[model samples]
Target: MDRIQEIVDFWFLPESDENYGKQREVWFKKNPDFDAEVRGKFLEDFEKAEAGELLHWSESARGSLALILLFDQFTRNMFRDSPRAFAADGKAREIARHMLSCGFYDELNTVEKQFAALPFEHSEDMDDQKLSVKLFEELGSGEALDYAQRHLEIIERFGRFPHRNEQLGRESTKEEEAFLKTPNSSF
Candidate 1:
């Protein structure tokens, strides 16, 4: 119990631009003593969010934190704490729809805001999908679609983002190292 509380406190500390992102990555990815139960709780809440279980984040700071965790994991390809029994069933679309309509996301940290687009990115709705294609077409003879496709393909190849290597203190592979050198490495 004490250990769990300590972890929670560590996570909830007031975030600042001063190495906050690096500190967070180290704590989350490097801490060997991290409590699994706390992580499990985070994952369970993420599952709840994906299942389209509505949460009133404005009414509860804890709930808002869980929302942040869900978005955080999505960016890293950790969609759920545990693997789902079935594939996504448009529940993410529903959750994304709700999040877009809510004001709660305005409260997230800066780096977290970078992943704020995950829900929209994974939205499988036909209309949304059509819009993405339409937008690409509207860019007419431009490189928008090509660039977007290449980036998406890279993500498909690497479950997690390769651009985050330096940020996360991870060693870059030769391919990633080469990719990182290109202007198209990251946006």
Candidate 2:
């Protein structure tokens, strides 16, 4: 299979309890091998996709999701702890919004929809955070909804994610510093 198909297949495995647990393990945990694999396999495609050269991928739901994964998820793994990790966030958010506007988002399963909604959830913008909460709620994703709500609450209080201060080079406020000490303050 092509790289895009490979990503789609790996990410959207058949829905089963064991598969879901494995998916969460990959999604939430840090694994150097998996990170290295994404870096080695998809880094070039990620660059091309970020440059807007892969517009054709938006022609279908699966393809669009793959593009989003490249922009949002893979970037984090490939460029961890650098500002470059967030460089493609705007493109990811754009693709996600396009997917929603084009009705492609409705074609996704719950797990897929959660990922498609993640760009918004990851945004610092309040409106985007609100939309993320709404989307998670609509999807009936209990854990995701809880996190989305927490993200929205943080955005409401701080205007931006304080956890990003160190990586983005923005100085955190004293209050933000205290909040950062709390567990789960940063997603």
Candidate 3:
């Protein structure tokens, strides 16, 4: 299978209750093996994609989605807890904006649409955060909408994600520190 196809297939599993949980586990929970596999197998491709070598991938909806995943999702796992984890965020957001403008985003199913909008959701910029909330609301996933609202609230309050402070080496303000202590503050 094509490398991009492999990533798309693995990350976007068939939708179901069990698969949704599995996807959350894989994406949210830290697993050494999964991280290592992503590092070993797709790191090169990721690097290439980052260098603008994979612009051709944007020619199709699935290809564009896969490119977004490489920049937004895989980078998080491959370089967890480091600034590098967010290095590709701008690129991912750019591709997402392109997808939306070009109408490719409309082709995706609910789960894929959520991911395609994630770069916006993960952004600290209030505008992007608001767009993320709008996208999630349109997608009609209560869970995604909740998370999007939470992320937007954080950005609205702090202008950034306090949870990323340690990784990015930024000092947290007192209010942000307090917020970070509360349950489910980071996401």
Candidate 4:
């Protein structure tokens, strides 16, 4: 398999397996320096995307940049030992691609069209249970839950991915924690 596929499969298998973390650990041990560099770059890109600079260029660019940001986040989480295996499932990729394709056609629609429009700010803060809920509603509960669970794993692995800065999230570990506690939680 190609390096990308190998990496993708390694990072995203399924949450039910105990071997996922072990396999990821072994891979990280085999490539420590490269992993660190990748993690750093991922963090940098993540921070940039979180700041919303990457999303302001164009609709398609914003969506594509979001995918890259998410991809890096998952890969970085893998190196850190969290190994969210469920991400490899095709549903998440399909939804992301669909979102990007929709973004490509966004210009064809009028400002008042109100189709699948994304928020103006493309920061990590913009990604939350609400977004997950919307995606889930658009897709299905299964894929949405899978994505949420994987996202939670990513945040837990980093000790701080996103949704941590909310005043309500200050004392919580899981993004879902604060989210669930909120009256606005759709899950």
lDDT of 1 by residue, 1-187 (tens): 3322332344544344355533355423523335444455455555665655635542433354345445443323332222231134244344444444675445545343333333333333344544434444544424445644554556656644467666556688888888778786664
lDDT, candidate 3, residue 111?
A: 77
Rank ordering of all candidates by lDDT, starting from the highest: 3, 2, 1, 4
Candidate 1 residue-wise lDDT at 106: 56
Candidate 3 deviant stretches above 4 angstroms = 14-24
- TM-scores for the candidates: 0.39, 0.93, 0.93, 0.30
Best model number under lDDT:
3
lDDT of 4 at 103: 63
Off by over 4 Å in 1: 1-17, 21-41, 47-54, 58-65, 71-92, 106-109, 124-187
lDDT (tens digit, per residue) of candidate 3 on 60-160: 89889999999999998899989999989999999999999999999987778989999999999999999999999998889879999999999998999
Q: List per-prediction Cα lDDT, in the order shown.
A: 0.45, 0.88, 0.89, 0.39
lDDT of 4 by residue, 152-176 (tens): 4444444443343342234545655
Residue 23 lDDT (model 1): 31
Q: Write the per-residue lDDT of candidate 2 for residues 1-187, one digit (tens) a residue.
A: 6766777776665344357523467776678888888799889999888777888999999899999999999999888888988889999999999999999999988888999999999999999999999999998868889999999999999999999899999999999999999999987
* TM-score attained by model 2: 0.93
